[model samples]
Target: MYRINPPGVYAHESAMTEPRLRARVERVAAALAPPRVPVVFTDEQLPELIWEGRWTEGLKPMGTLPEVRDPVLVFSTFRFDGKEAERGAWFDQLGTGIGGHLRNALVGGGAFHWFPAGLKEDPYRKEKVCRACWRLHFQVGCLHRCAYCGYGGVLVTMVNVEEYIEHLDRLIERHPWQLTYLLEDDADVLCLEPELGCLGPIIEYFGTLKDRYLIIHTKSANVEWMLPLKHNGNTILVWSLSGPEQSRTLEPKTGTLEERVEAARLCQEAGYTVRYKFKPILPITGWREDGARAVATALTRTRPDVISLCTFMWMECAEMVRRVGRDRFDPHFLAAAEAAADTIGGLRTAPFPEDARAEMYEHYLTEIRRWNETVPVSLSTESPSMWRRFEDRLGMNAANYVCGCGPQSTPWLRQLPCSAWQGVERNDQGLRGTW
Candidate 1:
């Protein structure tokens, strides 16, 4: 409930008095009123352990369970003067989710990127092969306790929202071909909510832009904060959903299946484009039934513009078992993964054979079609061969498919290619011929 800015912070005193800064700070504090959890502020990016310890101390009263721990929001106000020295510091502060080499590559440049699948010589190229899309990060770390993810325990957010918006405008103007900027693969940004108070401003900023759109990717159900914003149908909300069993066991401290779909329905009704991503779909016992029910819940409840599918594909089989526990996985999949462990060549992820993954994708595709056959369905982070296997059935290929968060995957580009739409401009009347 209280703002915790350490004394003699790196941010100048004038910044505290600046109308925009003060308004953002005060607004977030006010939103988190009747105080339950304390907000910590620091100019320096502290170690992850330090932030975790602070979060534990602040949320001690909430309970000892990881699910009950609402992370202590650390407002990092380290000023970036656009200098080389400070720029290095800025990228360094971008949490563990963004890697060191990637941080170096983004210096003095736009954070929006379509990451390559590495060079032919790269050893991990096979595992890394997937459709590329432009992604951006507003916050770095997460607050949720999903077993597959490492970004948890504390949420460190850069407080220069105005500065970021200004810079983002330039990035959008430069990349006229880019349609949507995914905000955030790193964190479940909305889980910080109205208390964070940054998303509203960012959403509105995208609303003012012409053809540019923002995709808010999250597993959190804290979307009431966005219901009132006039998104101008330029903002898309893609929920990283999972089956009921997986949500209950694997993804702790995140929204329930019903909660996420209901939130999607609300967002759709609010005139924002809504989408879903069954990411890392666990191949547990009764997975087919469970995944089908989840797809049904989403499709019947809310009309998603697109649905992207992804089988569980993170870390090696043994590593996942070690991290999430052996009992958490289905015995059949576990046995298959264990048997195939030594055969893993590229990235040790998705230990299942090609046929197993194809089965999973095909089952979900059938369930999706039962409700809405015409709705665009695509694969997420899948290899070229896998995409080719089902490309005919999906009516989408790796290159031209509408994705959960691709740069050119907006509703306007649903049926048209990016090249076809590029020649047209977005004016008061909208895109020439398309609109």
Candidate 2:
């Protein structure tokens, strides 16, 4: 029987939480590690999304303009008309069948991942974060658009934040185990927070559950307001940082590296666990030396609990990739990154240059160790080759970290991660993530 929530209220597929069944599904998901960094969906699907107003509506200005703001980010609210209808319908479609049950149990609130289990469990995994984290989002797109960027400029808000909490409560009720929730996957949770006004209510809700937490990753410095909220040491505050050059060229509207670092410090001082993600490391001129200095500054200044490094993979955002001219990229490294391309997980991605990335990873890792040897150092393992190389270099896959929630699942259109992959067989066996 299908249980429906009230109008404008999103529903969970299974009313009764099946821990055993969820465990079965999650075990398979955790065991099957992917070969590349994959999102819940591919950039190829962006066309259909944009046309429906589910993604972007050009770089035009909209919403209540921030009186004290830059002219570039003209728009205040996301042009996500019909998004509620689309997501509501998607939830309805997944409301039936075992597939929906599996999705509900899976990390993405319905998106299935092949390998849910990452590195072996360690007691001191992230210092402050749970090793296993469930990814949740209240919005899509972002307000930050840098030079070598793709999804940052887009900001698609997901209404029904309260309704989603109701569904999440059922997820927790089903399995009342200690777990962490990662917020702001599609957009920075704290960037437009003042307008949305969701942090307090969401934090209060999480506090009710036994051992529940919220992890937010952002580059924006608008975190001062959240410092005073009672988090119970549950929220893991993260900043996606870069050196001065990359920050200036790539991240335009976002604040300076120093500003973001200062925000991390404020959070740290306010009694919150802080972390850093030196991702999509643009290996440009003097990148190694400069990057090392930046890493040194972050480690020495903020002393975050963890530092995860990664290189760029903009293949999914073809439009953005086209917008960024070839001159902006390291041509020599680009060739190598392109050569390492392979179908890892469900998406088709060519990861960052492995050799060049290995060098950059070593530099950041070395610098991080200099100031804070206790802080865990990590490398992004979105690709199989990248994961293998990092594991080989570090002598082990960095245990304490978070991975993508897998390819985007369009439940309204195609609930499966890849509708095309369903017809095919892997190793001549049954389909993966199939009911």
Candidate 3:
């Protein structure tokens, strides 16, 4: 294992021969080979300029645009069947709304390369092979009517509990020793857990697996049902958080920040490890101070075991833009995302300039690091270089690798050097062990 120093930098000692690296690379290459999907869509198939009645007319720019150029129209696509009643409503609304813009931006500028028909082929599916630390949404639709949330009634949920559990069982069988599993398709696992009666069983099942870890994250404060469960080290509860301004404006349906923090405290007090995800970090005028204070308050209240930080990401989807609207959208947030994207070699070859994004990232990083120390920090859906810079600033290396196993492994591995191989000894005051 590698040893990670303060500020998060990684240094590896064991050198794999070219042949070994080549073989490992080959295996990953084979695993990443795109699977055949029944349905696929590209940007060219969608329309742009929704209700084209002068998009820029009378629209005052909210904030100063970062030095980065605006995004170029790239190809984008949305594929979902409207056959089932529940799913049909979701697809129709999404298609006519945010999905339209996403498709236009992606395909128009040739940004994202592929679009799958359903969530399964979306690559970020919750199964072990495809899932990332970012926690894939499980419920097809969201019930909460948060004004700022892009997903409201846009997705569907699986009504068949046993069948869904069986599907997860199959996934587990394929990767039995998997370290972590994150339920991401929806905001609150308990929101649907009460209806399906699956939370207890899922927790029990994961408990049976000695090495694996499970995390149930939510924005809901309806956690009375979770208070009674027998706690274990492998099971962690995470809560998504926003500042007071955001909670009042964008997330009126979700619990207030105080309530969420109280819930987190309750879980922690119950001996359940908890994680805090401060995502889509909004850029309201006083966001810097408000965001930091919110985080500090949460830390004092919950004393969480881990924390992850992320900014908003803009997809080429039209429905996404329409739902959020340019008015509420902060140019700084977009510029920060663009900067992160640029550092990673521009996921989309669009007009968003990389230099501007880099500056924005620097500003964001400097501001957020001021809140606290000791808690591990990471970005959601960020590029490698962005993370590299973060790690470098934190005096840490990429010792922690995220994916399906990231939630579990990151917390443990982040304690060591990023470059150290498993079983390696470090000179950090006799702290030596496999993380």
Candidate 4:
């Protein structure tokens, strides 16, 4: 019922006072009438909308990473009401289900899968479902068409926002404190905010509960819209980020790296707790230099409450590369990325040769740990057993440390071993816990 205009769309009274500008406003307003109900836009309709446009001109040329072999065509089907809509694609297993499918179909599959597995099986709670922290594409369809993304045909259909709200209301009534109503959906809250305005309402509704935390993760730089909303400590905003190089090369349409940092800084300034996710850390030729520089830049620019660093893995992303064609970019980089994951104990178990994977993991762990000692680091979708093996080597419990929010009470405290912490402190000069 309320109309919230997007920024940079309105005119000043000086212009409005002119008959011509006034008439134009009236015509534009009439043309821009709100739909009777929010309409779901499918992937078919997305291309026509200018918001889905992408720019990828200034990216670096693909380097020599090993090419993906034996690409697997995966179909991620979300079933509701016994009806199914299918999205399928070939991947080399380096991305999430939604992202992989989108890449295979849209961007021609040169990108790697970034989605982590076992998120649906939260190891912490046997009865609880451990959905991945980032669920942007699955829930909302693909909103932003980043240039590297291959999901051009992916459609984001809008479900009835009120209906979903009611569903949550009913669920809460039936099972009090049973659900951690975390909005880990792939669609960012900012993207949905303009349409549903659900944040304030959801917060208000959930505020009545005695137990529950609403986690909203995003990479969007749209912060002004969120500042005015009312939220209690029950909500946490997890932001995914990368260094300037990665941003420039890989993340084409998302907000600039500096803008994302500014957004995180603004959220912290607004008294809202925020978490940092530096996941799928790609291994370029100078990965150590690049990754360390990224972390240092982020640390200096925005002091988030918690930071989580992850190494890159490519189990489900191989198919994407095959679909996109090797000639588009150097397949060697992808192969090398796979090699790096294999070396790092984070490779997927079953069917994969254990001896080769173990050897790769050994080398990968040694390097990543050597660089980032303080921040709590963990693997996603890695077999619990394999993680345990590396956890022993790293001197931490990987099973319990699934989500990279750091520790529960003192999340800001880097969970490195005391010796390693001291080493990091000495090297990361001038770095402090507080902003």
The candidate that wins on TM-score is 1
Compose the digit string of candidate 3's lDDT tens values, residues 136-220: 2334324344544534322222222333355455554444334466765433556444423446666766666666677776777
Q: Compared to the true structure, candidate 4 yields what TM-score?
A: 0.55
lDDT of each: 0.65, 0.48, 0.44, 0.41
Off by over 4 Å in 4: 1-139, 147-151, 157-159, 173-179, 314-375, 392-395, 402-435
RMSD of 2: 14.8
Candidates in order, TM-scores: namely 0.80, 0.61, 0.58, 0.55
Q: Highest lDDT: which candidate?
A: 1
Model 1 over residues 72-122: C-alpha lDDT tens digits? 444444343435345667646645344432233223233343443333433
Global lDDT of model 1: 0.65
The local lDDT score (0 to 100) that residue 356 gets in candidate 2 is: 61
- Of 1 and 4, which scores higher on lDDT? 1
- Name the lDDT value of residue 53 in candidate 3: 20
Q: Which of candidates 2 and 4 is the stronger one according to lDDT? A: 2
Cα lDDT of candidate 3 equals 0.44
Where does candidate 1 clash, by residue pair? 1-37
